[model samples]
Target chain A: MLAKRIIPCLDIKNGRTVKGINFENIRDAGDPIELASFYASQGADELVFLDIIATFENRKTLANLVKKVAHEINIPFIVGGGISSIEDVSILLNAGADKISINSYAVRNPIQIEKLAGFFGSQCIVVAIDTKYIDDDWFVYLNGGRIRLPLKAFDWAKQAESAGAGEILLTSMNHDGTKKGFAMDITMQLSKNLSIPVIASGGGGCMKDFLDVFEKAEADAALAASIFHYKEIEIPALKKYLNENNVETRL
Target chain B: MKVVIIKYNSGNVCSLANALERLGIRPILSDEPDELISADKVIFPGVGEAGNAMKYLKEKGLHLIIPELKQDVLGICLGMQLMCAHSEEGNTDCLNIFPLYVKKFVINKEDKYKIPHVGWNNIVLNNEVNSKLYLNTENNKYVYFVHSYYVEKGIFTSSETTYIIPFSASLKKDNFYAVQYHPEKSGKTGETILRNFINL
Candidate 1:
């Protein structure tokens, strides 16, 4: 059986980690490479680097940072935020990113997904869906959850899959940064409906939350940013907790 | 030792190069037949459609040269699939090095297995005498895999893993080694396997 993945997401701004990852060993938490290496040492299954403010010039810097992180870590690395075109994906993949996740651009131009999947096999294309529950239905949001679209979350997930997306990174806007728990109902729905792997992101507070998402939500992977960034939950200990709970996490 | 990674228009070559660099080996990425034949070890790494990749290989005449090389050759992911006799992906004909057919993974409605089995999965070694790929490694150690098509277990299968069914995780024959999983992305256990390959 494939082991459940524990991912540590780092928010990057201007080529540096934005959140101050409070780890005793890490002298500079703002350094992306330092935090990435720390996570790798702690047995993180994968890492996601989200460029919060991905300007044109900042994208170049993020590429360089990605190259550095790729050299420093051996695990799978995913880069997201402001990936708009094939050239952007090419630059990052050539710079050594294992996968590239797209959100707003994909929502606007769904055909780009199939084109990207054709150019760079579907294995590396991850479609990140930012959704918020509203009006008795889950709606997809764009531009970092500041704008809401008329598209339904579940419908968009299915469309992305058919558009050749290999995986879906589902983030619940309500649960994001709340540290409450993953969006179990929607995550479970997406995972069951899609044949591709679903990565449940947003709202991971405790180790039990990881287990709950995996066991109840049936998420193939659980992604958390602040909890891991702030050192609220250590990855190794969390994996240990999941393993003990029969979640089959990588230890 | 001179290590040469067969260069094709495939993905993940950079990552594989970085991985070799991590092991303190500067590998040459080349498709030149002479360079491949002269290298101490050759690695055929790929991540693309088999038909497209095969077209590129044939265009470079690598299709004719890869099978004839006498030195140790390692094929990864799509490289492994291409080393087989045939593949269901894109209906492409492979190098026939392993004399096996690569089939697409099909999950039944009742089964929960996902296609493109992308995650860390354990391998069950076939206990072959020449199988040094798992040297100093314990059983059930997880390795990273990302593929939609897989080669069925055969005489050359060195290790097996099951997603929906048992499939060749690693295949080995005279002077050729292939793994469906990405050792470069599998962390420590994967590094150990790559290190063992270098030592071999």
Candidate 2:
């Protein structure tokens, strides 16, 4: 059986991890490569690096950062943020990224999904959808969750899968930074509706939350940031907890 | 030992190169028959469609030489799939290195499993304790896999894994070895497998 994945997302700015992720043993936490190696050593199934820098000049820096992280770690690495074209995906993949995630660019040009999937197999492309609940409908949001799009979240997810996207990284904007839990209702819906894997992102506070998402929502993978970033939850201990609860995780 | 990674425009070659570099073996990536024939060990790593990849191989004349090479060859993921007799992907024929057919996974509505079985999965070693690839690695160690198509279990299967159904996770025949998972992406256990290959 395939084990459910646990992923830690890191925000990158100007070729470095944004917030300092200080742990008990480590001193400095700003180095992206160091934090990535730490996560891999702690048994993280995968790592997602969201390059928050939004300038054309910084793209090369982000690719170089990816190369450094790829050289240091021996686990799957995903690079996201401001990936708008096939050239961007090619640069990152050449820089040693195993997968590339696209959010706003996917919204602006849906055809790029087919093109990317065609050029670089569906397995290399990940479509990230940031969604919000508004007026009893889950609508898609863009520009880092500030602008709402007219498309429904469910509709866009289906379109993405048909467009040959390998996986869907679904983030709930309503529960993003809240230490509550994942939005199970829509997550389950998307997972059930699509044949491709759905990675539930946003609103992960404790080990129990991960268990809930995996067992209840049937998410293929669960991605979290702040809790892991602040050391509120250690990966090895969390995997042990999930394993004890009958959830199949890589331990 | 001069190790050469067979490169034909597949994705993730750089990751494989980096993995080899970590093991202190700086391998050369080439599709030229002369370089491939001269190497002590050859690693065929790929991440692309079966038809397009095979077409590229044929265009470069690698298709004619890969099967004839006598050196030890290791195939990963798509590389493994292309080594089989035939593939359901793109309805294309493949190298006849191993007499097996690769079929797409059929995800039933009742099953909770998704297509493109991606993530870490345990491999039940079918080889003996002294098997060249299983050196320094225990049975049932998890390895990273990312593929929708799988080769059917056959006589040459070295390891087996169950996703929706039982299939060959790794296969071996004489001088050729292939694995359906990405050892480059797998952690310590993966490093051990790569080291074993290097020693071979």
* Number of the top TM-score candidate: 1
lDDT of 2 by residue, B56-79 (tens): 999999999999889889999999
Deviation from native of the Cα of residue B96 in model 2, angstroms: 0.8
What residue runs in model 2 are displaced by over 4 Å at the alpha carbon?
A19-29, B128-130
Q: Candidate 2 — number of clashing residue pairs?
A: 0
lDDT for every model? 0.90, 0.89
lDDT of 1 by residue, A158-177 (tens): 99999999999999988887
Model 2 clash pairs are none
Model 2 chain A is weakest, by summed lDDT over 10 consecutive residues, at A20-29
What shift in Å separates residue A61 of candidate 1 from its native position after superposition? Answer: 0.5
Interface RMSD of each: 0.8, 0.9
10 residues in a row with least lDDT, candidate 1 chain B: B124-133
